[model samples]
Target chain A: MAREGNVVNLVENFKTSIVMPTAQSFPAKTVPVMESDAVATSKRPIIRIDGVTKTYRNGTNALEKIDLDINAGEFVSLVGPSGCGKSTLLRLIAGLGTASAGEIDWPTSTYDAKGHPMPDLGFVFQEPTLMPWRTVFDNVYLPLKLGGVKRKDAHDRVTEALEMTGLARFAAAYPRQLSGGMKMRVSIARALVKRPKILLMDEPFAALDEITRTKLNNDLLHLWEQQGWTVVFVTHSIYESVYLSSRIVVMTGRPGRLSDDIEIDAAYPRNEAFRTSSDYGEYCTRVSAALHSASAAGDGEH
Target chain B: MSVIATEPRRLRLLPLHFMRSETAGRWLHAVVPITFVLFLVVVWEIAVRELGVSKVILPAPSVIGEALAQNWPVLLRSLAITFSVMIEAFLLAVLSGIGMSVIFARFRILEMAVFPLAVILQVTPMIAIAPLLLIWVGLDHVDRALLILATVVAFFPILSNTTLGLRSVDHNLRDLFLLNRATSWQRLVELELPSSLPYILGGMKISGGLALIGSVVAEFVAGSGSATGLAWRIVEAANDLDTPRMFAALFLLSGLGVFNFAALTALQHLLLRTWHESAIRTER
Candidate 1:
């Protein structure tokens, strides 16, 4: 199950990536204060969240003084309890909503004359939000179509996306005809169709069963590795965070704030062998403990 | 690997099973309603013939059929007039209703200013307004008056339903569109309109019936001899004490209503059968 050959292939691919700082490897409670890894990656940041704060009109501080930098080609997971505002942070990064204070800068990204980020960005919601009327191919073709690409012009890219998601055969199938997991694949394909450099996913596979979630987690890691996309995934699952992300950011609940930043130093192409290995379990335990303490600390404030 | 291998076979069988039940359901749906209608017609024919009901009061189904056959030319002409009016009113309602709804969706202030006026027209009862419309339109333009009345009656449902449908877009999908930087016009054509289609079609079904009713009500109120609609024929037959001919006209009117409903329903089925839950038939 280790598929040792895949590790060799992924190691060769990894030479192109920057050397990420290995921080707080295990024993979550014994860990010291998080050292800002901004200088460690050395590469230019894809997104810089500088002292960002989000307060709703109703006076809930969804996120407070959040400062982080997501470097290019890194898989970062925002993991915490239910009300942690991980989603709020993701939404801010996506520019779906405005922040109450501070700035989110994409220094490495391009912007158009309108002062809008012009980088190819894809966002996946918790639900597979596909148009029921459209077939899988049509759904994947949407972003390009909105960008004024005709069907004939977009045909190959859409097909390539479907192929990547293993959905090429189901291209003509309507959303209702697909299983939940398959629908989510179509959604992923739709996101990837634009060949986005940044992918912000909010619990994209949380609705799926364990088996499907595991399979998708593998597929997503593979896709990220192959495409070299900067990924910001938000999830409540510690095991999933440990299994998928290069770094896990733990946040506390109810006026969420970042509590800990733990970097996973595991090698690439993690498979069933990695999942079952003692190293994976240790990372999961660390993430789980950090999550527990973060939530407990949040509760103590009340 | 085994699970993957067996999945396609299972997937292939599901549609065949669903389609089989679907065909059976369709067969039952058509046969039962038709059988019940025929049964009622037979009972009506027998009861009228045996009880010796007067032709002037309760014409037998057989006599009504005879009257229909004899007046085919006159009835056909009236049908053509009534049908054209209904269709014209319906098409007008559809275009105006959807157009106004889109406008309302785009500009909320306009919807606020105008929607209540629409509701006022809807709730005030078209029958109460028909006579006034006739007077205002003038006897010289009775045809135009009928079209306006029918259009009013049929317009509201499409406008309201389409508005609700446009508003009912999945919020996540809306965010997705916003993320992709879809323009308002592109959003309307690609996302809003297609998503709202089932609602528009639903409204169309209701409005279709209303259009026919509006035309008949207008003809009744107009009372102008120039208009040769089926409603006019019914009035003329009533005045002459031709109960059989009146029944024949009423029969034609009901037939038209049924046809209108069936055609609209079929159109809805055609458009939404693939995606909409309401249109797709499910197995028990």
Candidate 2:
């Protein structure tokens, strides 16, 4: 009876706090526009990458003259061939590395009272990268713990994230005990627990089997629909970019630069039907053509 | 529905089967070696008796048992003395070694300056230095000389192991901590220390046995009436041609080594049993 009572209470609280507000705020027709059109409009840019260039100390031109404007609540994908520096670009946007030449500006800064930038961005690495020593709960609890959120206060958010990621049954499981897919779920939960305004995922589902990847892609879209955070997903897979992104930024290889920005005008709640539909295949083909040319252009330069 | 009904029953029986196997395995693990050792001892006793071996050359187990029984008080005192020295040196070595490792991890320049010296100390024979330590500290404080010698012997493994462990943290994990803006202290305590635990425990197992050896060897080098360790007893027995007493003291020394190793191993298991791959028992 006590367990049932707790479940009911959690559901009620979660509905009131998370579900109801997100449902109201996110209507069915608020699809994000392309960068070229978005720049002309009055929607405030979340991040502006202005002429950003990164040349490493080892004389490798990782990324060059990359300029992009990311609008709020957009699911943007950076899709390119290997060695295109897409991951490098994502790392720069996350402030993990500094761009050599240009600047990354967050027009609306999310800083705490102490003037320290409160971490408002979550990064999901290619690997799950969960702390093997910590339990799923503790691993998810890490960001909040680092940000000085007390355990008593962090418990609800962590539980909600776990539930969202479908890992509620495995809160006590260590990463080593988990399957590869489950470990990645724990990683996603850890990233989402912070309720960050922007989620930067670097090929998060790249390592999983196709079935698991599809399942996770669907789950991710559901969460994105529920919680409208800006997502910047980096991947080498054309189908993945076409399936997930509202706008796919195709990048060229070595000395990586933006080659094309293609917008997918498909409606929200893209599902298995969409995957099987002619529309999905058309988008994938278009993006694949763009990627093919991008790689071809890269080869000409070398 | 029937399959679901059978699943819970199978799950319930699973742990029961596992427990029975575990208990039987533990019994076999303990009993088999002890029975073999008893068999060997019995054969040894019979061979010595049947061969009419001179007691002065090689005493039988019964005669050594008699010597242990007769000189229980004296032998026990000496055993206590040896253990105390060994334990004190071991504790000191562990503390200083770990402490120095932390310091070295923090300061690269300091590690570069002193790590070679540590290696030099480790490779040099403690037996060669024990007599010098006795003279430097003076024969009046022979215990201190033995303690110093044993600590030197035990220190290097823990230091090297802990240092390697501290440096061996996963590069991606370090990047994660850095991205989170964790302080150096937080990184060391939460990440580096935990990752290093298995290595430190491995070093402790080696150092435990070495500590005992160092103390006994020091006692042999000290070679004084005031040095009342089991090793000293062996020396005294040898000079007086008490072969049975010498064998009894040697037996006690070997037992001490075994006990020390077992205790440290149990400690390693207790500390690492929850998560570490080394401590977890795999079936295959």
* lDDT (10s digit) by residue, model 1, range B73-157: 9999999999999999999999999999999999999999999999999999888898888789788889999999999999999
Residue lDDT tens for model 2, B1-284? 12333434444523444445767678768988999999988998999999999999988889999999998999999999999999999999999999999999999999999999999999989899887888899999999999999999999989999999999988767777877778888788878988898888888888898899999999999988479999999999999999999999999999999999889989988887767888778776
TM-score of candidate 2 chain B vs. the reference: 0.91
Pick the TM-score winner. Answer: 1
Clashes of each: 0, 0
- The regions of model 1 sitting more than 4 angstroms off are A1-42, B1-25
TM-score of each: 0.89, 0.87
What are the per-residue Cα lDDT tens digits for candidate 1 across A167-256? Answer: 989989999999999999999999999999999999999999999999999999999999999999999889999999999988888678
Question: Candidate 2 residues A230-258, lDDT tens each?
Answer: 89999999888888889888888888888
Backbone clash pairs for candidate 2 read none
Clashing pairs in 1: none
TM-score of structure candidate 1:
0.89
Q: Native-contact fraction for each model?
A: 0.85, 0.26
DockQ of each: 0.71, 0.35
Cα lDDT for residue A114, model 1? 90
- RMSD values, in order shown: 8.4, 11.1
